[model samples]
Target chain A: MTSWIAGVDVGGGGIRVQVRTDDVGLKARDRGPVPRIAGAIDTSRLCGRIGELINSVVESGARPAFERIAVGLTGMPGLVRPAELADQLRLHVKTSSVVVASDSVTTHLGALGGEAGCVVSAGTGAIALGTDHRSTWNRADGWGYLLGDEGGGGWIGTQGIRAALRFHDRRDGGSEALLRKVEHQFGGVSAALAAIYNSPSPIHSAATLAPLVADAAHEDDPVARAIWVEAGRLLAESAFAAARGLPQTYSWGGRLFDAGELLLGPFRDEVLKRSPDAEIRPPQGQAADGALLLAARGIPAGAIAEPYVHEFA
Target chain B: MTSWIAGVDVGGGGIRVQVRTDDVGLKARDRGPVPRIAGAIDTSRLCGRIGELINSVVESGARPAFERIAVGLTGMPGLVRPAELADQLRLHVKTSSVVVASDSVTTHLGALGGEAGCVVSAGTGAIALGTDHRSTWNRADGWGYLLGDEGGGGWIGTQGIRAALRFHDRRDGGSEALLRKVEHQFGGVSAALAAIYNSPSPIHSAATLAPLVADAAHEDDPVARAIWVEAGRLLAESAFAAARGLPQTYSWGGRLFDAGELLLGPFRDEVLKRSPDAEIRPPQGQAADGALLLAARGIPAGAIAEPYVHEFA
Candidate 1:
């Protein structure tokens, strides 16, 4: 019988599950829209949904029975109440061992290939987390949607929309490009306003404006360009805050990391200006892979070694 | 028949009606929260309620029939649709004269004592508005809570609470003062979180944290003090943006003005570092008074020879 492990990455928009077995390697994978529970999903619901996802992956018969499971959650409202969550999951799925941690921890684990470094996640939300080899963990920002969470998709989108609206309100003909883009994207002020107030996830809808802002940056809209540049600066600031007490090497991961040069170029420029010796490394795998790696360690008291691998095969 | 005018200061929390009749001088005044149209008084309902408040002031038998009525609203969402709002009000009350402008406009009118200067309003929201003697209006910030509105009560409160939460999450053992203050004022983190999310108006609830932050600043909490000091600097930046095209003689109003030395001392010190010649003065009257002054002349055409008065009374 092949020993198997499962990892789940639950986020604001969706949930991803990955299953890994020694012989079959990583085979079963699935994703689904996040379940809406009145307001937002509480910890119990979150853990339950994650457990169900893990069961589905295990029942797919692509991998052997899971001996261990790890769940990484991004964009969670608060810090993981690990013990309570673990207890809740025990009722649903029977795994030999489980490890629950912030999606950030997994992101860092995957991004640095489970090495000692820092990872800055700038997606719908933004957070910076760092770990030294000696088990010291530091984090900055990631205060959720209501407060801070600066230098992320939401921030960029907000800045873009605001600049567009201000341009519309000015009537003095300053930001023609921005106004035109807003009109094109959101139809009119009324529609835009309604969409902003009435949307299920206004932040996500607003975040869609980020790419438009990036396009505008290319077209020389000073306000839009400034927003992107500032996002880079802020992301760098968040990274620096996390990197303060860490070693020279660090890594970054997130959906925004895919932007490669456009985002990281400015981010690197800004980070180097503040912290001269910082080194940036690419993530080895997705957050789910890191979680699976953690689960594979099987009730280890110390930090798991070889937590993430670049290639599943 | 004496020509009577009503000045209404409508805010998010409630509406304040100040009726000025030429015969009775300042006459009877009353205020109440807006009635719910469906189940809740949203922005539109609040605005409609403002119109109702103005009409109540006019028909409450406190003064003789008025030739014209002027109203000043403090918390208008935006100024693009004031004409539509005017038409709506015209449907309710049979008043020949009605002028609709931003609350910042009225506050500036009052701060300058009907003279032409600048007023920076830092209440639940923040905006800096300036008028040259030549009738050109310049504005800085005040893009609403979603956009900018920086240096206001909402901004300060939000930042202060975020800092407190950061201190709480750090577990670094310091920030005991901040933790105690948060527990005392907002209950625990759960209660504070609920109040922030579940309150009728999160902005106002956030604003409630300002005084506590002020106390913390007084107590020399470095983080708390930094919040206020940074708020002051941002307010000054907003002022500087408006003051760029105008002369040095400028006045300020809004609730933050009442804090006076406590708020402006640090604000002015920082502002003067950039602009040495700025002459700051107190507001002549409340925003409602400024609205009355404007409405007396006619909504669109009212032009005071001396818009700003040096003395309060």
Candidate 2:
């Protein structure tokens, strides 16, 4: 009498699907690009893509047919009505039981075992999400890719490239190493110019240069290194916004919750410099897992030992 | 005996060469990518390229036997030492007479008929140059493309995209047009993600979106139009900085300078609301022509008419 459930993570780039059953545990996982409908994608079309992805998982010969499906979407704005979103999803994937939540909610649930803590996702976009013991959720600064996604990979990458160009233009005497590395990665300034001017997705091309920034930071490129530090500071600012008002009983989830340390070293240092008692930890799972747990009817309340119970294949 | 002279204008994107002689008038113009030397381009290399360009005009058999070369560079920072820059130029072309000045200086010279006034260049970069009747020069906010460069086409384009993205994330119901336009231009959110992630020249790519912003503004997109208006305000801020003293006069230069009516409509409105006596006019000639005027020895002060001369072919 075990129930099967599906979880969908919709992002700006694509959609990911994960299915699970009590008997087999995590069953099928798949990913696909969100299809564009009517020359553009709306809520209905996006939900349809999610439905199609869920159907694909069902069709993949998994037993104990799913009784419920849960979807976690990263791209949907917070301003949208939750009830309306739920209705939209029902239109595409007709099911007696379905749950929809913010991708941040799921990510936090997965990372901290559905506990009361915060999660910061800094990929192409950036946002900080936190939930209190009473399930009061709050978010700050996922304003989308353009306005502020500050301290995200894209921001770091963009700032890095801008610094390299500035150093190139000003010849500030000690930027040869940075310029050389950037030129090599970008195939010289001419190619960089063409890619920037003629190409459609210039930001994507620029993001590839992120590693160069990281490398320069390691090699002590002042400008490049400074950008990372600044990124860390910004990331911390976003995280601090989410961490406010959380009870002292809710400590940050361990190792898995601490991924922010990777990009927010300077930010953490700065935060610690300001606040001596800050609870930061590494996250154990991801947003998809959180969505799956929510689908399975688990409301994470507090810290639990070895919380994530997914059967990895 | 009507000696000829060549003026070279080097910008962030490309370089332009204009040769002028008394008999031939303004003959022979060429445009090409800025040349790089030694697999890279430094300040010295850029100066050398300017000299070589001038030498090309001298060897091209343009009559009246050119006696001097004037080089104007838009992207160069403040003058550390003019003598050193002059010495760098002497390394390439054989000429007894060579003058190197900031492209802004020449732009102002041409824009204000070699008299005392302010000149603002708002292109890929932004700067304001000014001089009093005593020939004391002043500059405000041309800090390359990284720190400021506000009010330029690049800044406006970047702001437009940012605003569009913000409006998208806000889900405030008034940004469908802008979101659609951005998605169409950048080839969907995934491509935008990739570009922001992978490119080496994000600013350049951001700058390329200027036309799209302009188009959106033309269509009366509020966010897009706001970007242009904001740019005008920022440009006006630069003009204000230059016109700090009493009874200030200023001229606008750069490609965006001509977009005065469109970009500056709101900006001028805002400026007049604050500073009613700010005299702003479009420049007569470009930076290259300004360089020629700068290089021309002994042309009595105030001989050149206000608004200088406008010749375009």
TM-score of each: 0.77, 0.54
Q: Residues B124-150, candidate 1, lDDT per residue (tens digit)?
A: 888887775345566777765666677
| Residue A69 miss distance in model 2 (angstroms) | 26
> For all the predictions, what are the DockQ values?
0.22, 0.07
TM-score, candidate 1, is 0.77
Of candidate 2 chain A, the 10-residue stretch with the lowest lDDT total is A304-313
lDDT digits (tens) for residues A1-313 of candidate 1: 6677777776654667777777554434445555545554466776677666666655454434457777777534344455566677777776666666678877877777667777888887788887752456677777666666777888887777777765654522135677688788778865775677557667777777778878887888777767777788777777777776677566677776565666777888888887787787767887777776666653334643222211111
Give residue B280's lDDT in candidate 1 (0 to 100). 73
Candidate number of the best TM-score: 1
